[model samples]
Target chain A: MLEGLLVDLVPYGKAFQDLDHRWMNSEASFWSSGGERHFMSEAMVAARHAQWAEERERTGGGSGVGFGVQTKDGKPLGYFGINWLAPAHRLAMLGAKIGEPEYWGGGYGTDALLLLLDYTFDWLDVRKAWLMTTSMNARVMRQMEKVGFRLEVRQRQSALADGVWYDWLAYGLLRDEWAGRATLVEQLGLRERAAALGSGAK
Target chain B: MIEGTLVDLVPFEDDFATYLETWMNEEAWFRAHLWERREPHTEHDVKKFIERMEKDERGALIGFQAKSGDPIGALIFDHEWPRVRKAEARFFAGDSRYEGCDEVLDALLMLVRYCFETRNLHRLDAVALPFDEAKLDHLRRAGFVHEGTLRRHIRWDGDYVDMEMFGLLESEWPGYAAKVAELGLQPSGLEPKPKPEKKDEKKDGTG
Candidate 1:
């Protein structure tokens, strides 16, 4: 498990799987799916999990890796991970979501992202990490910029949400450009939580 | 077959599989045309790929035949998501002689027409490696706008290279078509009709 100031990245077990339908069908879906509407049944979520397991087994866990996000006290919040990893290029695409609305803007997502980035750059040794989001996802745009990710591409009118078109934005961060988890915690004002979590936090 | 002034977009046939065998083995061409890592493909592998492409409903693989009846290259339209009315376009000239030539431009224009007009797709996306200037120029000339660059997107010979992304929307086609007509690059059959002298006479009489 990867530790963070306010949350821990742990195996996405059955508990998280049970929550998939609710999270995927809620407003949280828009953030993760780039504004595409999704209606995932429990059975569909199970099938998706089976597919992910088969893929992970076939690729020996190299193609993609994901984890559930939970508070240090064991309360589930959301999940995030490397959506795709290309070892040949040492690059990976990262995705995350704070499924619980109450946790929104509380820095839980940021701490989870920092943990994922730490795992990606330090553990996986990826040279670059990137992601794609729509311009309508203001939270993600601010989160990406705050984490020092550069806005690399903006495909105009590429996505539609609520009958309006939005630009598809791609953000990239190099391994060398990452400020490390500790620095980010301090920069993002999560240091108070880090202190409460004790010495090895952040 | 979609016929153009300089080339015809023909359907893929067993004969085209041989070109794939050769092109897939050409390291430089393969690197420039595709994003995946390079691996040697046998004749059987190439045949399997052709059969799959033939049966695939998601997209199309079209061959380019020059006016002289020689297979010069191929145009690929794949990654099609019909629900969203979008697809990706890629092409390569197996015959080096036709690379960056006017015939290639003719082929591209035909592709654009087919995608936006015939297929009625909403958008077409394209990508080019950093070293592929001819393709970059061709995409721009064919009405695709440079959307953004994916930094260190592909690995090339122990180094990483950027890939430039381009997009063309259906609404933008008329402007590009006008530009093509203004530049006299449209095929003879598709060219804008010349103004009639009778119309000029009628206007003069009205005045």
Candidate 2:
């Protein structure tokens, strides 16, 4: 269902060094927020490892982006992931930890979520996708909504960061949306699906 | 809180007859519907009236038993305002044993909420008679506003009487539901909120 260049997954613990500079930029806390203070040390890292591993053990999820995100020239910018989801539900929650604050507002989130959602719904056959973000992170929420997620619900006093609870916003999107594919199809001089559907309409 | 185990309108025929008798005599507008201008001759007539409600083109029962549980009130969907998705309501405790009671008012409020929030209808309206002073007071207490009066709206006895209109909007249903739920007397079968997810996407994806 999707035609594009495939992403190269960086090997586990292979010192994806180019990606390391971005990682030390510590996008995890930049996105997860509160730096190392909120969730501390190797214990926190072990917990992260266990949480994802247990989920994978239960649901058989693939390693998100195989380790890290890399640009065409091999410059690593962010790490992306897809939470395994069932076909009928059709949506896999997605997130990216981009280390570079310089790259924060520069379309990195949109491009990565598009690429992840593109893979989840098309290659993975996801029909609907949902994700959550906090009201504190209005920037990320806007990036999510720009990619076609509409607010479905909001939970109050749910985010317990820095010993305080913040309101969390949840959003959802459907597969029929993905303007990039239509733009690409147009760019590549392909027949519009409307032409194919014309006969069905009759 | 007018609640008891719900009984179908058939066995509760006396309740229906009592409801009809008071309605016919008390409101000049209802007198015209009774062929005898008195009570139904038998339980068969009350059953026939309820059965006739099923044949109504609206395609669903008009009222439900709530608060007092013997079908004392209703939240009929799509009774009028075809384009807007609206309903009309009228209710009474009916039995001479229960006149002047406010239990049916609680029942009507429950029914109004079921029609608006649960059924997703935009509007609800009630038509009352100008001389029907106390019922109009009940409607206002239930959060409905008098929209206007319809002069010569229904022929009563030998003459038409002015009819009063009351209306409510769906936007007002939630606060009303909150107020009603506080009474611990709910319209049967209304769910509270979103069901608990088997696994709530945990905060920080660490559920």
Please tell me which predicted candidate would have the highest TM-score against the true structure: 1
| Docking quality category of candidate 1 according to DockQ thresholds | acceptable
Error of 2 at A33 (Å): 6.3
Which structure among the candidates has the greatest DockQ? 1
Q: Candidate 1 on A112-180: residue-level lDDT in tens?
A: 999899999989889999999899988889999999999988887778777777888999998878999
Off by over 4 Å in 2: A1-13, A16-27, A33-37, A43-67, A160-165, A181-202, B1-181, B186-207
B133-168, model 1: which lDDT tens digit per residue? 788878888888999899887788878888899998
Per-residue C-alpha lDDT of model 2 across residues B117-162, encoded as one tens digit per residue: 5666666767666666657766777777665554333445565455
Instruction: Give the chain B TM-score for each candidate.
Output: 0.83, 0.60
- When only the first chain is scored, the TM-scores of the models are 0.93, 0.65
Backbone clash count for every predicted candidate, in the order shown: 0, 10
- The lDDT, on a scale of 0 to 1, for candidate 1 is 0.80
Whole-model Cα lDDT of every candidate shown, in order: 0.80, 0.50
In terms of docking quality, model 2 is incorrect
